[model samples]
Target: MSRITLELAKKMIENAEKEANQIGVPMVICVVDEGGNFIACHRMDDAFLVSVDIAQNKAWTAAAMKMSTADLARVAGPGQELYGINTTNNGRIVVFGGGIPLRKIGQIAGAVGVSGGSVEQDVQVAQAAVKIFEDFE
Candidate 1:
């Protein structure tokens, strides 16, 4: 399977930044390869410093798990199937919105994450980035 290219990762970040700007929220965006390795990251002006780590971990979680962090959140809660799973990955797993796996030719290629806003806002930015991946040539 082909992995996400560096060019695509950058495009994802650019689209994410545009969405964040449109919403008036500075953001930290991260991309990870299929193996959960860091590919690229961007911190918008005025974004919180803490968002850097959050965004990276979110991308890692999505790539490693091969699922959106939002979907993971549903099953990671108390009494759910993946309960306490987040604590197993040295606390790097993020069980929330704002992380999504990127697919290429029907295969998971990588993931993108966004932070520096509310969960909903972050999710919006992340979704915008994923749209770039979806439309990639």
Candidate 2:
């Protein structure tokens, strides 16, 4: 499986940043490989510092789990298993909105994440980025 290209990562971050700015939300966007390793990250000037980890975790969760962070949150629930996972990951894995799997030809290629905004706003930015991959010809 081919890794996500740097050009694609740049485009994803640029598009997500633009969308976040248009919506009046500063954000940190991150992209990761299928193995959940960082490909690239960008933080808007006004984005919160905490957004860095949030964005990274979001991407990591999506790549590691092969599912959207939002979906994982829904299924993980508040329980022993979820708690264990959190502990196992040492806080690297996050179940939240803002993270989405990146697919190419219907296979997961990587993931994108956005942070430093409300969950809905983050989701919107990440969704837009993911859509770019999905709609790529």
Candidate 3:
């Protein structure tokens, strides 16, 4: 898999921030590489401190699982075997709506996540950032 470059991470963060700002929603954005390592992060001034950790967890879940956090939530049904995966990663695998996989040439390159707002708002911000990669030729 291709590595997520600093430039790409920066762009994703910037776009996510812009989207959150446009909607008047404060947010913390995080990007994680394929190995679930942090690539970059941004927290809006009014964003909650806890949002940083939440965003990172969302991104880690996406990167490590190679799927959107929304999908993970579906598979991690109550009492399902995979449900434990959500907590197995040291509480760093959040199966929520604010995370999305970053793809390059149809392969997962990394993940982007957003927090500090409602799940819908956070998902919107994260999706805006993921669009950068999705739309890339």
Candidate 4:
């Protein structure tokens, strides 16, 4: 499948939620298509309300930029090539961890984002979602 299906999005969220629970952090998980359109989102119990928008923005940033936000963060730092990029795109771009593109056959299919935790925890959850995507048949 070239695009993210609802089934895959839901699976990604499920895997992310499982990771969040294991990490003992409530999270807001989001999935988006290649065009940066929302596919699915989940707010765990006790998750920060503000994470709702952040999670989706992370997903959008990943899909639109076609790279993980963690990688983007490196180039987006002060005096870097993409410095101030977050200020552009109407402030929708996130320059940190927890946003990852889902690739199928070396093509970007969609993305997953997780928030409401520390950067490490969020990245763990997003990585879990990517694991599901990679393991899909």
Candidate 5:
């Protein structure tokens, strides 16, 4: 399992930024390794100050859990397998669509998180970034 190089993390941020710009939303984007270690974090000029923390938490959650935050949100709801999971990890878990696990050959390498937009727009930006990473070696 290869780690997420700084180069790849930058690429993810660059692409995510483009998407956010096109959507007319400033954004905060973060990437974390499989161990939930920070690889990179970026915030657009007009992005909300609070979004920085949310973006980082989203990436951390996705990486630590080895799953997309969107998926986690599904199972983390009331009466679900991961109920109260958000309360764990000292509240790091975001359980939202903007965080996506980046996989290399079906193995988790890292995760990307985007914020400062609607959840759907954030997911779109994150998905674009992850798609680019998937095509890289």
Candidate 6:
């Protein structure tokens, strides 16, 4: 299975943190490998404690599914396709905007997830990390 290096994980987290700081929110950021194994998690000062698990779950869900959680939210909505998916994966799937898969060398490398901000802010933070990962490649 593909994996993310600690260096890359740090870069992703740094970018996510930068976005969170720009948005004026303390965030919990997580990076998970392609197999949904945790690589790193960073909880900023004053970040909501509840967001720690949420961030990790978001990263795991994104890497495992190879899709953004925001996209999942569409299909996983009540009465929609993939409904109850969140309940099936040991309750790990995060059907929201904070999760984004990280692709490297044309394959899934991992994912980054951010929390402690609004959904839009979370998406923005994750996107920043995605861009950094792409540039790192």
Give Cα-based local distance difference scores for all models. Answer: 0.93, 0.86, 0.86, 0.92, 0.89, 0.89
| lDDT of each residue in 43-125, candidate 5, tens digit only | 99999999999999998888888888899999999999899999987988997789998888789888998889888998999
* Predicted candidate 1 versus true structure: per-residue lDDT over 1-137, tens digit per residue: 65688888899899999999999999999998988899999999999999999999999999899999999999999999999999997899999999999887778888998999999999999999999988887
Cα RMSD for candidates in order: 1.0, 1.7, 1.6, 0.9, 1.0, 1.5
Q: List residue ranges in candidate 3 displaced over 4 A.
A: 79-81
List model 6 lDDT by residue over 12-84, tens digit each. Answer: 8898898889889999999988888888999999999999999888898898899999999999999998999
Model 1, position 113: C-alpha lDDT score: 89
> How would you encode candidate 3's per-residue C-alpha lDDT over 1-137 as one tens digit per residue?
45778887887788888899999999999998877888899989989999999999899888888898888888897886687777685777897799898877788788898899998999999998988766555
Q: Could you tell me every candidate's TM-score relative to the true structure?
A: 0.96, 0.91, 0.91, 0.97, 0.95, 0.94
Q: State residue 60's C-alpha deviation in candidate 6, in Å.
A: 0.3
lDDT, candidate 1, equals 0.93
Q: Estimate the overall C-alpha local distance difference test score of candidate 4.
A: 0.92
Against the true structure, whose lDDT is highest?
1
Give the Cα error of residue 20 in candidate 6, in Å: 0.8
lDDT tens digits, residue span 1-137, model 4: 66678998898899989989998999999999888889999999999999999999999999899999999999999999999999998999999999999888888888998899998889999999999889988
Of the pair 4 and 5, which is ahead by TM-score?
4
* Shift of residue 107 alpha carbon in model 4, Å: 1.0
Residue pairs in candidate 5 whose N, alpha carbon or C atoms collide under 3 angstroms: none
Model 2, position 129: C-alpha lDDT score: 85
Error of 1 at 41 (Å): 0.3
Residue 96 of model 2 has an lDDT of 73
